[model samples]
Target: MSDSFPLQKLQNITTPFYYYDMELLERTLKTVSEEAQKHGFVVHYAIKSNANPRVLEMIRSFGLGVDCVSGFEVQRALDAGFKASGIVFAGVGKADWEIELGLDNDIACFNVESVPELEIINDLAAQRGKTANVAIRINPNVNAKTHHYITTGLKENKFGINQWDLEKVTDALNKMKNIKLEGIHFHIGSQITDLSSFQDLCVRVNEIHEWFVSQHLAPRVINVGGGLGIDYEDPDQNPIPDFEGYFKVFKEGLNLRGDQEVHFELGRSITGQAGSLITKVLYIKEGVKTKFAIVDGGMTELIRPALYQAYHKIENLSSAAPEEKYDVVGPICESSDSFGKAVSLPRTSRGDLVAVRSAGAYGEVMASQYNLRNIPASAYSDQL
Candidate 1:
């Protein structure tokens, strides 16, 4: 499946819409399954990344499980035809209603982040006459070597339970009757390109595993939550991430028990390259230092650039003119709405088609009606 967009077809559709390459998506899923199955690792698609119905349904059809961070996502996964037994819930601030929803659905496990959350899930499960399977989310303090905002496993970050509080967590687990201890979960951060960080995590988990055995506890699962990164600079050159190498890291690093199953909650690596934000050039404004290619899509359409200063390769599909430097920006009022500063693209003009590559994961899912702008529509390769 080619990542290139059809400018003629895109011209007929509305501007600032998502264009998904379903063929690419399918191939990516197949690769992920092949690699994960090689090591007998189970993968759960993180719904927080992209909950588009079509995307979710395709993932479900691949026989992958769902990893939800909220009650609504759990319902979304269910509505998309993912089985309740294959769904796993993980969040730091799960509301009471969310816990009830999970209990009613009998989700595979809830990755408990704190003692209070563990207690609440237990209470909710008891009220429902069900036992909630839970995995304690541990803060291993391992650096993911990525952006600070997305780094989650550090002790200072408000994500997993700190190492110092393991004793309290175990004690709370012993007292929480309605909850069944299932495993240990860790998600250090997002968009992690460094493999060494995962190796560090494996070492930490081995140490933590010994601690659990010392306490006479053996878990049935070991969930090393996913943070695999994708190449944003050259999506076509490296459309699919190095799944073989990625799974190999865990195969070699992690210490697994005979009865335990290893699981991963992958998001971006699976979907990032399969979607692009197709926007039309609204105007061309001459600036002091650089020309501005003003696009209809803004922070509202794709917020990753404005939110995390994330990079997405920008292309001008309508022109084959000599390469020219431009500051690709959106119509939003905020200064941070710029997609790429000093982006080199073909000399562009009004109504030129521009494609923002590598937006499948957090693009449409995180879009908003900010500025009262109508939410952008989506187009798929199959449909177009």
Candidate 2:
């Protein structure tokens, strides 16, 4: 659905702020909940995507769990009203205190990425006279075919345990009495548009699951970590991701045992289209080939475009003139600090309000204070 911004009201507020369509976010969460519930699957909102308190609160209200990659994230989830029992800690380098935090809180599970981490969790759990529930995060070597920066499931990635090392992990698990092997986890990558990548992951997961079963260590939960991408190109046409089809892939692909649970750690697909970076054109500089629509906001506010060369549709909310090609550059010192180059937009001018669409997931969360610029403020549609 195309978002209808209140340009009059938005103009009254400061420019270069994040404008969240809460209605859209709620609808996305509702769809995810309904679709995941259809197959009795558990969903954990990957908090790293957007840890905004309001967003987290809304997600928690939908009865989804939280997937945390750090101790701070775990605490943030707890502070946001998500129950400790619904938090799952995941990371490659969890410190001792982070592990201790999970033990003290009795979080749902720790998606262990390495045998050393597993051992440390066990040791810490033993010290507290507790058993830490853990899910072995396996590197399935499945190519997500997305940006290499976000592809995490391949053997070269530092995210999960490689298949060849599973034997060592199993042996370690056998001796770690304080650790409970509750499940197996896999995260292929981020911004994955191809459903076939997930299918490949499912096939790999089946093989790994059978191997685990052969070793008499069948996991109770199969956590297929979330990599479902959203339509960054055209948020209007596909605002809500196809959760129905996404869940169906897992339902038909996975070979689940009786009473086994399937879990997902979705982040972007649910929130990507719900927010936009609202900025104001500061100056129009004539370039050799294309005009430069330099906006007040830059990579400090949204870095996806600069970091991964990601595409986000730019619209001139204040312009209704005929379309023209303009390089929408941000007011940053770096040459790469741009939203889009050669972007087609309505005839833009100074003071025109512009919107960078499909940025809800990684926009506000990854904001930085580079160039001493204040992190952009946020405004919700309902509040506006």
Model 1: number of clashes? 0
For 1-384, candidate 1 gives per-residue lDDT tens digits of: 233777788899988899999999999999999999998999999989999889988998999999999999999998899999999999989999998988998899999999999989888888888899999999999999999999999999889899899999999888878989999999999999889999999999989988998898898899999999999988999999988988998899988878799999999999999999999999999988889999999899999989899999999988989999999999998999999999999889999989999999999999999899998888998888
Q: Rate residue 300 of model 1 by lDDT.
A: 95
Q: Compute each candidate's TM-score over C-alphas.
A: 0.98, 0.99
RMSD of 1: 1.2
Q: All candidates' lDDT scores?
A: 0.92, 0.93
Prediction 1 global C-alpha lDDT: 0.92
* Steric collisions counted per model: 0, 0
Query: Per-residue lDDT tens digits of candidate 2, residues 1-384?
Result: 144788889898798999999999999999999999999999999999999989988998999999999999998998899999999999999999999999999999999999889889999999999999999999999999999999999898789999999999999999989999999999999999999999999999999999999999989999999999999878888999999999999999999999999999999998999899999999999978879999999999999999999999998888889989999999889999999998888888999999999889999999999999998788998897
* Candidate number with greatest lDDT: 2
Runs in model 1 deviating more than 4 A are: 1-3
Return the clash pairs for model 2, or none: none
